[model samples]
Target: MSTVDQDYQLPGGGANITALPKISLHDHLDGGLRPQTIIELADDIGFALPASEANALGTWFAEKSDSGSLVEYLKTFDLTTAVMQTEAGLTRVAREFVQDLAADGVIYGEIRWAPEQHLARGLTLDQTVEAVQAGLDAGVDDVQSAGKTIRVGQLVSAMRHADRGLEIAELAVRHRDAGVVGFDIAGAEAGFPAGKLREAFDYLAKNFFPATVHAGEADGLESIRGALFDGRALRLGHGVRIAEDLVLESEDGDNSYVSLGPVAQWVKDREIALELSPQSNLQTGAIAQWGNDLIDHPFDILYQLGFTVTVNTDNRLMSNTSLSKELFLLSEAFGYDLTDFEVFQLNAASAAFLSLEEREDLADQITEGFGRA
Candidate 1:
């Protein structure tokens, strides 16, 4: 079966996780292209690939991304982005991305991509955004026609290492009414702090736009602080490193006392959602300090502390996973049941870049769907 078609049941076999309504906030458009689509697009563009066959190419991406280094995991994007230079390439990949999300039972998703990366083939920034919106629209139509419902919005990202943050921020804001919902800064989070994009963030803030910054993954608490203070992000993309700020004070018979540092406290108190992608975090070594396994992730700790934690499949192709698979894996590792999964979905619904009414509608859908399941 295709990755999205695979059925995933809750641990001990209660509900089919694939059929559960879900929300995805941190999925990458460039990173989720189907391998077969990449092969055809590369062939059309005369771009050479490491492996010509579809299955082999998919395996190559998975293996390469399994490396512990975030830098190494990010290198897999070079191939995926190569064929996505043209309007047709972008549209097709986006359509299929939405289709996959729908098949995996995602009722809402916020797809993020860097427009500057697709300019190599001479398409203007506006053209790229328009092309992607077309694809997203087509995908939504396809899902509706198939008797399934899905909604998605674009989250335009500025490359942190590339000093064009202000330009990209303008691009996103210009298309806010079209399909863009929010702004973000991605790519190399360690050395390139959010402070580097102060101008862009300032403009976004002035325009009253929303943003979700990628931090606390490849870096630590300071990176998250920069994302909050400098970027003024509404949500944190993989803010798993905030666990570093949790100080374990003392342990009793069955209780352990912990203190939250300034950053963690602010995140919890403000209800900033942490977009935690379990498999992606493990592959990128984002949770190495905690341990190498899903059980070792700080997700449970953060969730128990009342921090808004949402589950995501950051890169479906590179991680060879789906939203259902991610939830299933987490359930297996932590013995979570349907109730826990529902809470995660509700957290994502609340944190989506939508109006309060729209978010409430989404929550209603989740509650209704989970009730049926």
Candidate 2:
């Protein structure tokens, strides 16, 4: 089943979440490639896949990622990146990625991917970035031609397990005016702390560049601490584990009394946005301490605690999900109405790396769209 065409409507026929305006803050470019596109790109490069057919390949990705292991979940990206080593592959994937987001009603989205992983075809970092930018521009033009509005920016990422943090950071800053909006470090969050890339974060800070670090996913509170204090992260990637710091004191009649640890209190008080991916968090075991189901997630806890909680699809392909599906799942699990959905979109708009004016404009767009929905 391709999630691309899933009919996800709010319960009681309230509203169609897909048609609602959305802002995606933590979507991955490499992770959201179309399954058929991957098959074509892989065939062009003579790369073998676990499944040759598009539907089977999509199922393979979802199965491999659903193994309840972060390392296993990440291995699926190797096949996707293998096909993205050339200019045509990169451009087409990026172009189609935008079209997919626009089709899903994303008003604004930040697509993150690591250039270091795409250098196998003898393309320089700058060339890869330019190719992606060209594709994004083309995608934007196509969207406008269709009488729809969508905006996209790149978040250049450095693989945390690799030693190219400084190089990737420089590349992001170099293309800041072109299309890149920020820098990030992803992959293997536990052993590879953000502090290991302190030099890159330092350089980004010196250049006034913002960063969002992947922490509290395959790691814990200490890792989130490093991302904040050392990496100076403006936001957290799947920081669902930050709930580990909260101590559930007691539950009394539709309410749970909880005590926030220092770190949890800090994140909530500082309004550090938690880019919470409901399905991905379950697949990656990020919320294993809590439970497996979406209802078991600390998202409702964080949201009720006044944390800046935003919904995201970390890997649409792997999870067989869309942002609307995620929102629908949360609504089904938590009994959220259109107003609750509005809050999530507004949270994402505020956390976008856009200027204050642009963020406000996005907020207005979301508000107006939800008003009509």
Candidate 3:
């Protein structure tokens, strides 16, 4: 079966995890394209791919992204974005992204992509956004026709290494009423801190736009601090490195004492959602400081401390995973049960860039679905 059609169950023959409703907050548009779609689109554009076959192309992405450096892992995007330059390519990929999410039982998702990258094919940034929105609408309609419900929004991302932060921020706000929900800055996060895009963040704040900055993934505590202070980020994308601020004081049998630094305290106390992608974190070496495995992920530690932790599949194709698969792996490693899974879903719903009423509705849907399971 395909990855989207794969079923996952809780440990010891528990409920089917794939059947449970989930929310994806940090999924990337350029990172989630289907391999077969890439092959066809590349052929249409006369672009060469590393692998000719669909399965092999998919495997190539997985293998290339497994390199232990975030910079090296991101190089794979050169191929995916190459095929996504035209209106048709963008629309088709956006539509299928939603369908695949629905197949994986995601009720809601926020698709993020950098529009500036697609402009190489003579398409303007605004046109790129419109094309993606059209595809998102088509995907939602298709899901409804299939007797299922799925809602999605676009998160326009600005490449941090580029000089179009303010422009892209305006682009996102301009499409607020259309389908765009939020703004983000993604790319090499270490050197290009959010402070570098202070003008963009200032504009977003003045316009009352919400943002979720990509911090704590390829950078450390200072980058996260910049996201909060300079960017005014409402939620953190892969904010796993905040664990660096936590100091293990002592351990007493079943009791352990830990002290949180100011940054960690602020995030935990304010409940800034951390979009933790397990498999992606492992592959990209995001958790290398702590260890090199899923069990070593700081997700459990942050969750235990009452931080708002939500699970995600950051790059479905590159990681060769689904939201169901990420949750299943966490359950297997941490011995989590239905309750823990439900908490994670509810956390994501709460962190979603939706209004309070809409977020509550999503929480109710999650509660009802998990109750039946």
Candidate 4:
């Protein structure tokens, strides 16, 4: 479409992953801004970025995010978030985010961002949501005008370290009819467990709302357990470490065998989706214990064990990636073909926080597209 097919051959040539229909389950809104857009927004607000040139600013984000420390990686958001404190900035960024996702062939996506982080400009939390919705709506309209349809939902996030979980959860439910789809608790997950927002999760549950918590990435089984029990999360954000519960016995040439402990069994049995960001996982050292390279990721193992694994670009600009790029990297590392790639999309479609009808429609769209590919 944009002369960027995102398709690439594997060691053994076949279909390119970029031409395949994709669903992005874990992309972040604030983390995916264009470098040029950042420069303009920062300029409009009289704000200074780490670099004046867009290319230099892009390099700055990449460098900071790959520092292998969660706190250091998170520092990049400070600059991105700094420019997002106004209505114009929020709307423009949101609209552009969707347009870019559409360009990447992501038919459906869920964008998560913290609203509390955008109120520095005197806008109320509800006002910030409205501004972002305006942008997202514009982006959707832009897609339709281009003869390509893309749908997006906002997973309004409450910074876990802050005490505004209940308020943000209510904000999400208040905007439920207006593009806001789900609730999430993101931020430093090590010290702040999902249980910290027990009141908020309980409220979401009572209202029949859905949540997806950032767990099992910074913390361990206890955090994941809390997300399931306390947060009542329908899906796990980057729940890669659930593989830590997997115990391997042996593997031969033709076949391999392994056993799942209680945690792993429950996750698989319950069919919780894992939003695995391959490159982000590698950069953040999330998979450091397994290996340094992409091949060392537990994604293939989780997929083989019947876990609902979905591919994502947790932060596109910072990781210098797109949904297509992540798929290409995965295929290169794991020999994935069209069928394997389609399975990932199907998994994401099923895990999307959407109505049964919408999910089914998305599944049909994915299935039909993949059929053509």
Candidate 5:
């Protein structure tokens, strides 16, 4: 319904990517706040920032995240979370986040954030969850009032390096009936394995709750193995490194052959969704073993191999990107057309943590929108 869809379009005069319905999974709430919002919240809390102006602060975040290390990329969240300690800051950011997603034509989204990181201002875990839920509800109402339809859910995350996995898991379960849909474990994937959170995973499994683990991004195949076996992850966050399990054998004229290791085969066979973020993967050096550019990304290989691949903007503000922009860049890189884009959206819709009927409705909405475009 937004008329501001002229910015992103397919090559060769095809449909505009921004106007197409989309689904966003693996988007982080703390990583998507506006730079101007950060400045205002920082001012209210008397917190010092690296840059004074909004544009400069935005550049600062992008620059910091481009350091080619996941640890360095994660340091930018400290500033965003600092201002988000209070109720007002959290609500405003969540509201604007959903509004931005709707304007970009996202019909459904799941926002993941670690509640334990926002407890600096004397707020309990449940209170933080309530504040964010209130904001998400308000944002949905705002979108509906503007003649657009959008739905959002929360994926509560536990910081892997911290010792509160069970606590965070319990917090998520407490808010499951409200708006929380699933659970996730994020932060520093190499040294902190999914096995570290076995108790948390066990509890979620016992309660029949779904989970998605951050693996194969900062780490390698063993991390992914743990994510699948120990964490029992239904979806993988930035699972680009699963490509490591692929072995290139030989290539004849116009023909190349490759073999998948057991882990990669299992993931592909089981239809586990891979939440791949192109720009963020390049920035964090998650695909550095392949090459430095998007063309070198294994997304194409995985897609061709029948893997369940879904595109995302892992940290939109940090990567200076949106879901539309990410899809546009992938199109430019891999020569994707409207059909390819539709497949990506369909994959995300199928992987969403919703009832089968809800997913079918979302698929119908997506098909109708794409058909009209």
Candidate 6:
């Protein structure tokens, strides 16, 4: 059976979690394309792939990404990204991404991808955004046509190592009225802090645009500091490593006392949303300092501490997962029940880039969905 078909009885066979309404805040466009689509698109563009058949290609991605080594894990993106440079490839991928999310029971999803990475085919930055927006619009329409409703928005991304931050930020502001919802910085988080895009953040701040930075994943607290101080990020992309800020004060048997450092204190007090992806976090070694198991993940600690913790599927294809599976894994590892699952969904609904009314509506939908479940 496909992974999506595998079902888990939620604490008493309450309901299949996959049928619950959810919000996806951190899914990547380039990382969610189908292997079949890649093969077809590659053929259309005269590009080569590691495998010709769809199932073999799919296994190829899962096998390569399971290597545990960070560099090897990232190599899968090279194949996916290579096929995503053209307008045809980008649109098709974006469309399928939305369709897949709908199938996974995501009512709303914010799809993020870097325009700077799609310039190889000679499309201008503005042209790239338009192409993605077009794809997103078609996907939403298709979802509605299928007798299901799913809303999607583009989170225009600028590569931190590249020099197009300011340009991409402007491109986002320019397309804000047309499907673009927010801004983000991705790619190589070690040396390239959000401060490198100070000018872009400044522009976004002036325009009152929302920003989410990839911090505390490959790097530590310092990178997260740059994201908040420089990017003024409204949300954190994979802020899992922020767990480093907690200093264990004492432990007595099963009860361990911890103190929040300045950074953790600020994040918790401010209620900044942490976009935590369970599967990808383990694969990328984001939680290696604590341990490799999901039980070692700080998600429960951060949640219990009242941080705005939300679950996400960082990259569906790379991780071979969905938001439903992430929640399921967390439940199995931590003994979380339906109430805990509801909190994560509510947190995501509240942190979504939508307006207050829409966020409230999403919360209501989640509440009703879970209540029925």
TM-score for each model: 0.99, 0.98, 0.99, 0.96, 0.98, 0.96
Top lDDT: which candidate number? 1
Cα deviation of 321, candidate 4, in Å: 0.3
Task: Give the 10-residue window scoring lowest on summed lDDT in candidate 4.
Answer: 1-10
lDDT of 1 by residue, 212-317 (tens): 9999999999999999999999999999999999999999999888899999999999999999999999999999999999999999999989999999999999
Give the alpha-carbon lDDT of every model: 0.95, 0.92, 0.94, 0.89, 0.93, 0.88
> What value does the lDDT take at residue 181 in candidate 6?
94
| Cα RMSD for candidates in order | 0.9, 1.1, 0.9, 1.9, 1.8, 1.6
How far out, in Å, is residue 29 in model 3? 0.6
Q: Model 3 Cα RMSD, Å?
A: 0.9
Worst ten-residue run, lDDT, model 2?
Answer: 1-10
Assess candidate 6 and give its lDDT: 0.88
Which ten contiguous residues of candidate 5 have the minimum total lDDT? 1-10
How do the residues 50-118 of candidate 5 rate in per-residue lDDT, one tens digit apiece? 999878888899999998899999999999999999999999899988998998899999999999999
State how far residue 327 of model 4 sits from its true place (Å).
Answer: 0.6
Candidate 2, position 309, lDDT: 93
Question: Which ranking of candidates, highest lDDT first?
Answer: 1, 3, 5, 2, 4, 6
User: Candidate 6 at 305: error in angstroms?
Assistant: 1.6
Q: What lDDT is reached at residue 105 by model 3?
A: 91
Of 2 and 4, the candidate ahead on TM-score is 2
Instruction: Show the colliding residue pairs in model 5.
Output: none
RMSD of 6: 1.6
Instruction: Report how far residue 213 has shifted in candidate 3, in Å.
Output: 0.4
